[model samples]
Target: MNVRNFSVRRSVVATVAAVTALALAACSGGGSDADADKPSGPVTVKVWAWYPSFQKIVDLYNSTHTDIKIEWTNAGAGQDEYTKLQTALKAGKGAPDVVMLEFQELPTYQLTKHLVDMGKYGANDLKGQYVDWAWKQVSTGDKVYAIPVDAGPMAMLYREDLFKQYGLTIPKTWDEYKAQAEKLKTASAGKAFMTDFGGNDGGFMTGLMWQAGSKPYSYDTANPSNIGISVNDAGAKQVMTYWEGMVNSGLADTKAYGTTDFYNGLGSGKYVTYLAAGWGPGYLASVAKTTAGKWRAAPLPQWTAGGNAQGDWGGSSFAVTDQAKNPEAATKVAMEIYGAKNTDAWKIGIDEAYLFPTATPVLESDAFLKKKYDFFGGQTVNDVFVPAYKAILPFSWSPFNSYNFNQLTTGINGAIEKKTSWTAALDTAQANVTQYATQQGFKVQ
Candidate 1:
C-alpha cells in the first residue's frame, strides 16, 4: 500500500489570497447541481484512488456485479490528488464519480459541497459494521459523507533491546515518559535521543495534540460559514510545551519526518522509540530491516495516569462526488469497495497491503488479533493497537485544514530553529488560522 507514503501524507497549501478566492467561488457556484450526465445502461462509476492493489479489488467487484462497474484510476496520492480535486471543483467539471479522501481532508471538500451525503444511499444502515470512531470521522450529526476504509490508531513502538539495556520499563503516564526519556539520554551517554519530534509534520503533531485531549477545531455543513478555532487550547499548549522542553534539552531530536535522515536514524539506532500508529509496524519493518526482532509495540503513555485516551494519525475513505453521473451506483461502490462483506477485497487490503481494518468483523477477528510479526519478535501487535483504536475520542476537523496545517508547519519550524517557543508557536497558529478562516468568510467562534 506504500503505507510509509500514506503515513506521511502532506498538506497542499494554497496562498491565503488564492484559497479565500477559491472558497468563495466553491461556496457559491460548484457542486450543488443534480447529476447532468446520467447514463442509460449499466453504470460505469469512475473512481480516483491510490489504494494498493486496487485493480484486483475492482476486478473482483466487476466479476460479481452486473449492474455497475468500477473504473479505477490512481490520479495521485495525498497532496497531488488534493490539488487536482480542488482544481476540478473550481472548474465545475472533470471530477470522478468518487474519490479517496483522508479523514482530515474530508471536511475541506464537504465545506465546498463537493461531496455527496452517502446517508441518502443507505450508508447509515451500515454503521454497525465499522468502528465508532472511524464512522464518526466520515460523519457529522446525521450526515454520512463517506465510507470508512482503514484507520491508524496510535501506539508507542520502541526498541525492546534498548529498553532492557537502559534498565527501563514501559511508561504508563506522560510524566513517566519524560523521566524515561531523560534516563535513556543519560544511559546512552548522549549517543541517542529517545525519539524525534517531527517539526515539519503537522499531522503527527496534530495526533500528539489529539492524544492530549486538545479540541483545536470545529465546523459543520449546517453552519458552513461558522468555525470554532482553539489551536492554542490548554491541552495543545501542554503537548507543545512538553515536546519543546525535550527538544531543547536534547532529550528528543527535532528531525523532519519522512526524510532520509529520520529513516536512517531509526535504522542506525539513533532513536530508541518511535511514537507511531497502527500501520507503523509494517512501515518500520520495511525501512529498519536490520532492527527486526529488537522492536516491540506498547500502549501510548497516558496524559493523566491510568487514562486510556488515544489518537489517530492517518486513515482514508471513499466519498461519492457530487459530480457523479449515478449517485446511487457511486455510493454503492464507495460503501462496498472495502466493506466487511467483501472478504476478497479485504484479503488484498489487509493481508497483502497491510491496511488496518475499520470494519469490526475484520478488526475483531481472531485471525487479525492473534497474528504475530517477526519484526516485533512474534508479538501480537494488534493487541496494543485495537485498544488504542477503540479508545480514541471523537475529533472535529476545520474546513480550512490546508491552511491550518501550513500555519502549524511554519510555527513548528520556527520553534525547532530556536526562533520561538512551542507555546508561542501554537498561539501563533491559533491566531493565523482564525484570521484565515475569517478571511475565507467563516465566522470564527
Candidate 2:
C-alpha cells in the first residue's frame, strides 16, 4: 500500500485528460524497442515499481532464477509513474514489461487496453492464493490484469485510556459509535473529539463510503466505453449525512488529515479515536509517541451490528503491461515478485516496509497474525485487520478515478466549509463527472 499521505496514495487524473481517442489510435502497436532483440540468455524483464527497498526483492529473484532477470526501476511514485506510463502507452513504445499500479488506477489503464491479461499466463490458477477482495480488485470476471501485492484493510484505532476514562465501550455499529461520540464529548467537556471528519481526502472518504455499501463508480469490462456514476447514491448519501451531522454537532473535528493541525490533534489527544487502515499503527506510532500504549486496534464500527462489510484504503498490485516482448516472463515476474513462496520479499515488505499483506498465506500466517506491536501495548493488530481484509466487499473503480477523487475533494471541502451540503456535493460531483465522462467519449449512465 502506498503511504496514505494521510492520503498516502495520492493520484491524479491529468493522464486521463491527455488520453484522447486520437492518442489511443497510436497505442495499438505499442511495444518496447528494448526487447526487440531476442537474446540467447535469460529474458531481462524491465519492471517499473515504486516499492521502497524493492531492490532486495529484485536481487533475491534474480539470484534464485536462471531463466529470467529483473531490471527494476523506481520510475516514481503514484502519479509520477502513471504520467510516465501514460506517455509511453500513447507513444506506442518505452513502457516497461511490468508496472505497479494502485487498485483505483487499474481501470484507467485497463480502459486503454494497455494491460496484459495475466489469466492467459495462468494468473487465474493463483486466484485462491490471494485474499478474495484483492483478487477482485485486479480482475474483472475472467480477465486477470494484475497480481495482488499488499492491501490496506480498514480498522479502527482508538485511545484505550480515553475510552476507559470516558466510560465508553467499543462501538459495535455506526449508531453505537455516534452515541459514544456524544458520551465522549460530555465526559471530556468538549476537550476531545471522537475523531476528525477529514473532508479533504477523497480516497479516505471512499473507504468510508465503501464500508457503507456505496458503489459510486462502476465500469464493466464488457462495456469498456460505458461507466456508471452515482456519487450521490443512497448509500453514499447515508455516509455523507452521517459525517455531516457529526461535524455539525461538534462531536467530530473537521481537520484535513496529514496536516500539522491534524497531527497535533492525534498527539495531544484532541481526537479520541482514529478510523484508520492496516498501515495506521505505524503512522500513529510515529506521530503520537507520547500516546504509546494508550492506543489499541479494533474492527471498524460496522454500519450494521455484526455485519461483515469492510473497506480498503490503500493497496497496489503488479501488472504486466502489453509492451512486454515476453509476456510469460513478465507474468512470472508479476506473480512471484511478491508471491507467497518468496519469504525474503515478504519479510522486506512486512517487517521493513510495514506493508499489510494481501496474500492469504501471509494474512493467515500465525507469525504475521501473532506479531505483537509495542505501540499498541503488545496487541496483535493484524488479528483485527486480517479478518477485516477477508471480509472486504468487492469494489469497482471508474476509469476516471483521479478526476473523481479531485471532484470529491472539492465537494467535500466545500461541504465542510459551509458552502454546500454533503449530499449536494455528491450531486455536483455526479453531474460534473458524468459530463466529463461523456465528453471523453464514454457513455455515462
Candidate with the greatest TM-score versus the true structure = 1
- Span of ten consecutive residues with least summed lDDT in model 1: 1-10
Q: Please list the residue runs of candidate 1 whose C-alpha ends up more than 4 Å from where it truly belongs after superposition.
A: 1-3, 6-10, 15-20, 24-40
Q: For residues 1-445, what per-residue lDDT tens digits would candidate 1 score against the true structure?
A: 2235633355555633464466655666544555566677889999999887788888999999998989888888877777787778667789999899989888877767778988888989888887677898899877899998888888999999999999888988889988998998889999888898887777788888899899998767677777889999988999989888888888998777888889999998899899987778888898899999999999999988889889888888999888887888899999888888787788788766678888888878887898899999999999999989988888888876777878888888887897578899888888888887777778888
Task: Please provide, for model 2 over 172-239, each residue's C-alpha lDDT reduced to its tens digit, 9 standing for 90 to 100.
Answer: 89999999999998999999999998787777898889988999887776577767888888889999
Clashing pairs in 2: 3-8, 4-7, 4-8, 5-8
Clashing residue pairs, candidate 1?
none
lDDT of 2: 0.84
Q: What number of clashing residue pairs does each candidate have, in the order they appear?
A: 0, 4
